[model samples]
Target: MSLLDFLRRRGSAPVARERLQVLLAYERANRGYSDLLAVLREEIVAVIARHITIDRDCVAIKMDRGDTVSTLEIDIEIPHKAGALLVGT
Candidate 1:
């Protein structure tokens, strides 16, 4: 592959990060709890960061509200091979 192709593939990280940020922002704005979610997300990421280095911008936290229950979804991208070890594969 050409250098251009390699560079193009590597560019996806920023794009994904921005998309996740936008999505999380939209979710927070719609359902409220913006402050609580922000703190919750940071705390969760900090705990994970203790063991593995991660990009803060790449973390995505989503909250879904249902009729009877609420759901909190978090997506963290591990940028290295260490993730496999974490999963105990």
Candidate 2:
């Protein structure tokens, strides 16, 4: 894998020293989010867990800021399961 891509892979625990910027981005965003990331993460897990099984740690939350608006991104890695795919309502 390319060096940059390697650094971008999100894993558990505090990231490596070289990845402090990434860590800080999420940290600052969460702080900017009123330091409620843990609480928000839990609430999100609770709601989604009700519908499907998931590895809670697999959820990666991020916030990217633009001049006018910021975007909140939640990436969840769902494992394959039979008949788990849901179609349009």
Candidate 3:
């Protein structure tokens, strides 16, 4: 396939837009958005630190509250492949 065709095909792949939308809805429904975010951040950092070293300054956790629910938005900055650490983190 041509480069353009390959790029287009890759871009056309189905995205997790629905999952994100659901998460947003869930977040909005939850109260205490900031408190929840703080708790999530602490948990995430604690979980990450258990396995590897992470730059605390780079760690970020946010809550996106939609019109109905609140969703936990976790943003982590790690230096290695430790995706599994985030499972319970």
lDDT of each: 0.85, 0.73, 0.71
| Candidate 3 TM-score over all chains jointly | 0.46
For every model shown, the clashing-pair count is 0, 0, 10
lDDT of 1 at 80: 66
Which residue pairs collide in model 3, if any? 26-69, 26-70, 27-69, 27-70, 27-71, 28-69, 28-70, 29-68, 29-69, 29-70
For candidate 1, write residues 1-89 as lDDT tens digits: 99999999999999999888877866767676648889988999999899888899989999886646779999999976768778888
Q: Which of candidates 2 and 3 reaches a greater lDDT?
A: 2
**By TM-score, who's the top model here?**
1
TM-score-wise, the better of 1 and 2 is: 1
Clash pairs, candidate 1, are none
- Could you give me the TM-score of model 1 versus the true structure? 0.57
| Residue-level error in angstroms, candidate 2, position 80 | 0.4
CA lDDT of 26 in candidate 1? 65
Put the candidates in TM-score order, highest first: 1, 2, 3
Model 3 lDDT vs. the true structure? 0.71
The numbered model that scores best in lDDT is: 1
